[model samples]
Target: MTAYLPMDREERREMLASVGVDLDHLFDSIQESQKLKKTDFSGLQQEGISELEVVERLTALADLNKRTDDYDSYLGAGFYDHYQPAAVNHLISRTEFLTAYTPYQAEISQGTLQAIFEWQSYISRLSGMDVSNASLYDGASAAAEAALMACREKRLYKVFVSAGMHPEYIETIETYCHAAGVEVEVGALNEAGKTAEFPTEKGYAAYMVQSPNFYGVVEDLPLLVEKAHATGALAGASCDLISLALLQRPGDLGVDIVTGEAQALGIPMSFGGPGVGYMAVTQKLLRKMPGRIAGETVDRDGKTSYVLTIQAREQHIRRERATSNICTAQALMATSATIWLALMGSSGIRDVAEQSAAKALYLQEKLLATGLFENTYDSPVFREFALTAKGSLDLYKLNQDLLAEKIFGGLVVDDNRWLLAVTEKKSKQAMDKFVETVVRLAQAQ
Candidate 1:
């Protein structure tokens, strides 16, 4: 048994008093019907245990999980399993970088500000845009924020989003639109899994699409952007950062805003997050972009310095006048991304992208040759693709079987449709094993 320090009634009262609130006052806003009559501790141990015992208990619980390292995973909808360089962790784990907060006092925080400046520079180059913010929450929220920025810039109440965009990103955009009194119209996807058409309305604020979209099909961005321009709406793209190394930059393709999840740039999936969201905009929408922007300047000593240039968020400006309500940037995650990019450089990133694309193509061809799966779309893909199970094959059961063989299969997007992802980390041997297992399972079915 371990000695425990429980807060007595007197201690609780004292703490509450110090905060200038009573227990009832704290719960005043909560609905009576929703209030819990008693706390439920059903799953917890009733008695306290020693520190060592607590660690052992937690370890036992953790061991119950099917960790990715133990299995060959093909799961990448938005988050990917890219190779994270050892330097990313080593540099990010430094006490100065780990504990640093928002660089509000740039005079004393040059290192943090410089890291952010470098991150912004990298994103600007990656997206081929005029300006990039320090960072946002994640890819979904970044897309939503871009929609808000477009609405504000175009001064319109309606926005058009492609059906090919990630479902979660669409949902997030809808949530932001609902709060901002804006309307979202979802465009249709053609047989090739590209946005087929855009609303021919003149009042639309923006038309958004994702390259290597949810179906893993790259859209004809130039055509889509042309159509959006015809309707006087700015075109926005939520792209995969890694694909940008091989694909043409959205900015060069005339996209007004480019946003994406930067997780592939050395950040671990960690069961889906703490990923950095990067946003870049053309010169026209630069001032309207959300989050923080780091700008280079000269100090009193005539040396170079980096400082927060534009903060259009609610925390920095008057509430009603603010461009957005975003309060802070993902400084640590952004630093990791910056370091990753610095380490990989341009050629290394291109190599990773090319390898991923090649592996995906190889896997797709092998699976299709097995006659067990059919292609969901006939478009070119960067790293991921969708396949439909042939005949009466059950995708759920197939995935379970794959798991049994220590191979985590693709993510099931719809009925009998699996969205499979391939990364540079997946070797040819692993690919062959996955294909063989799928072929055997199809035969069994």
Candidate 2:
């Protein structure tokens, strides 16, 4: 607040005069509609507030938010509501793992580097790629970095993306492309919610698609990869990590690069993010990959050790020649994911995948059986699906009513379409209650 500024009255007047204005007109250049007023500060302008007052105010504000513990949520577009194992926190929270976020010093940070190496190994195996980076910021930023990598590798300024991909991802890619003077052409999706066959054009560096796309429709990865190769372009995909337990790995399908959200693995949604983004690439694209990479080698004693192997970001390499600007990895979230994958193994991931898909299918069936909703797309899904309300429904108001009962509902994709997600966390009773709430709201409306 201005009241607590260290500047005295004379200093303030002089500073105001230097800008050719008095105190009352200091913000005169600002538009009247957007100018800040003293009244906006509420209670901390003229009189200084104590630490206790600040705490009380912040506490009151915090009470206005809806906590996940109090709400049964079904909203997973990218970030999921999957249950995190208790051991994940207990392990990642250890002092050695918790504080060693960035592994710049290889000698002192072997433990951190090794953790990241394990994370990369898990990502590579899960994605079926030959190599993987330490990690990235989140799914959206990782997708952007993938596009950049493709364009740089092929020396082409244009790339093709699927319209079926998440809109947020598309926007992020566009931002990265715009800054780099690259062009992004969005391919169309068929009526069944799958990305259409690639175009016959030849000068693109890569083609990107999201499997189990925004509509939760699985795209034809092999077909798309073949088409991309036919056009002399690399194939890239954004996917869900857990879905790979049951689906074909992208590397086996000829995809050159795989990037996706790993939030479902162990990280909580935390009201949308800070999510862990995993990126894997074939052996050919290892150098082109952005972010850090941890590698294993023997020390002087001939014991196993980990070190920072590759860092191709602006901070490490020549700025103009650097692959990306991102330097540090999301250490805490990545550690959680690595621990979760280690504990889950193959069978645990498969079970989570199966149960999530089963629960999602059951939820969809219940909604459609109510006669108030219909299928939006004719496609198979992993853990999320969409439905079209058959009647006029105020989805916003409907969610409010659900919240009143400590329930958080589906995402409104558009006007009448609802995107519903289910994870291993959702039980039959919870989904039944969601269906009942929707019916009750529809009838009330």
Candidate 3:
């Protein structure tokens, strides 16, 4: 037990004894190094802290983060620095919206269910898929769950993932596959930062790719999807959701499943997450999608009504038939996304996508002109791109210096490479200043 908690040692021992397990047995599945000890935090003072002290402590810790309020961020691997409209926050905080967690009571949860239905509608239209679920945990889990859905559909144990996909997402897929006794094969990417052609062999349940993939280089979605279909495998994409505003819809490109992180849709990075994941599928695969789906209908009196419709998760069906164990939706974040989308109508979203892409190109050009960075691939980027550091460029020191100036430099990918992202919020002046700083720092190094 944690020292901070109010439980006494004897009570804890008694509780465990009643359950027929010791402390060690309770934590046996966890790695020994990760198991927390009594001394981990030094515990709170016996008298406890006042509200003011707690606020002071939290504020102090928050100040330690070298983030916005004084910084320009250029980091994006999965999450981004897209502008979050004030309206999104203002609307989602209303008592009628904020307090509702689940739509268990159809009659009482009309507002919550309606928000979810709109979310699903927006996602379905964005991906050009037949339908969408309410929500998933995050991009990684969404991709992993899509892979499982594909495997179940094809009744095949093997799946292939593009190396261009985010490394962490690939790791998540592997973890899920391992548990289900499925085989995962990682396909290589060509010099262009797109997944290479599938091996000259065929048996795969699915082939998953990420557009504007981890390298920030866009993939050839149509070609990849065709290749997957040629092998009788379902084609899926873990997309960069904002890019969908301008890029071809995955469904139109024959992508059978579309899964992605919606953090850019008005949600803050919040130091990497609490991301909301979305999954959209073709009509044929709708039954196998995990999580709940909100639907619109008419009440007996001919009044509009909203309710949870298709629920194929472990919570709704027999354990053996359930598509996934996920029981609840990330309703709050999903509602935020819906609000974001509603505020940023189609043209608004398109403008953001276009400006982000243009800014990315402008920054990439400016960086190359500094002669301290070189393009890593010939492929076009959306809002993020990778560049290799030139000679004598101290990437770490450069970032540290930038940090002192209240600016987050590019994400360090490796010793010789770094990835930079540009959002609609990053103006041309910021890009120019970033380039000038890089040049001066590299010259000094």
Candidate 4:
């Protein structure tokens, strides 16, 4: 379809007249409350400039927003600045993989299907589940879908999420459930920063918790799963893909559903997106899973082939009865994850996770030694932890100071509490500098 853009006012008017439509009719679906009252761009006008000059101006503008190398960001709410191996991008950028669209013909799109199959296998192994779908928008949507999937078994309509889950994920589940008349109950986080029980029992289909949760504290997966099952609710555990290398697998903990953002696996942060969400479940719940699931099969000659199977649960076939409305998702990122996993193998991945945890513990101890901050929770954590800053400390001001020093401070949870995260990427010297910066800031305060 051609875009009906008019180069001149006369052409715009003529097209509107020919279509028997006014500007209002052209955008009739936009609610009055949702529409902006006036165009803000109307006041922004610039004189004629050459295309080269405009390009130069844009380059300068981009530089202004570009973060300098000196700044070390510790922020990771949903997105993290993990190191992505060059091979990951090189493989994903292959012409066939980069340009591929959704595979509609199972027979002809074997390459795409095979990649999805590998993605499913990796996710399944990581979560300790029997099966996984291709991918989803992100971790939050995946969590929401897991809730709906649990509802399929018992026809219950409520979802219980722990406050330890990323707040954004909790909000995403609520947004999805509201339209479906599914109530969401959020449980509180205990002093250990793990999710506690809900005040009252409700007919919930699923209970979602996060290990190495939003506050950077790990939850008690075995106990949490047991409690959820006692109420006949499915237990869904969201985890950091990298952390699973050291921690107990969600499936090993007896979780029915496991899902999380896979960005830390291999993909770049990419400004918080284009990240894939991985979901895996026991084979017993496979039929209720959403999104495209690639399966392996043989041809008439017994030659191996890959195909997308069991898709009747999706929107096009099931309509309102569909498991989910998610159609297409981050296949390219999923491919990146597959390549990264293959490159690292099991041992290499485990080393990365262990090294990251060690570095984080080193930083935690150093920070506490300064007597300016202390660990907020008493539980064992992964690569991230909550620290309580002392004195008349202003997080915004401290961050500003850290910015000037070319060091990114930890994420501020409150005026006095911050969440710090470390990875294999940061070296000993950098970690020392970060600690020195924090100590100086504390002394000044």
Candidate of highest lDDT: 1
**Any residue pairs clashing in model 2, and if so which?**
none
Models ranked on TM-score: 1, 3, 4, 2
Lowest-sum lDDT 10-residue window in model 4: 62-71
Specify the poorest-scoring 10-residue window by lDDT in model 3.
312-321
Model 4, 1-445: lDDT tens per residue?
A: 3445546767777778897877567678988898778856656665668979989999998777535244687766667666778888888888679888888787779999999999999898888999999999899999988887888876999888898999889889998888888888898887888887653475889888998898778889998788888888889998898899998899988999998999888677766778889899998998888888999999999999998888753465666766677877689989988999999999989998998899889988988898877779988888888888776777778888888887777778868888888888888998898888877876686
Q: How accurate is candidate 1 locally (lDDT)?
A: 0.89
lDDT of each: 0.89, 0.87, 0.87, 0.84
lDDT tens readout by residue for model 2, 1-445: 1244588888989998998979867678789888755556666588779989999999999989887667888887887887788999999778888767576677889889888889999898889999999899988899999999998899998999999889999999999999899999998887888987687989999999998898888899998898999999999999898999999999888999999888888787777888888899999998889888899999999999898775533455566666777887888899999898989899999999999999999999999999988898889998999998776777888888888889888888777888988888887988888888888878998
True-structure lDDT of candidate 2 = 0.87
Candidate achieving the largest TM-score: 1
- Over 4 Å off in model 4, which ranges? 1-54, 68-70, 198-202, 317-319
Mind giving the per-residue lDDT tens digits that candidate 3 earns over 404-425?
7778888888777888888999
Model 3 C-alpha lDDT versus the unseen true structure? 0.87
Q: Write the per-residue lDDT of candidate 1 for residues 228-334, one digit (tens) a residue.
A: 99999999999988899999989898999999889989788888889999999988887788888889999999999998886633455556567787868899999
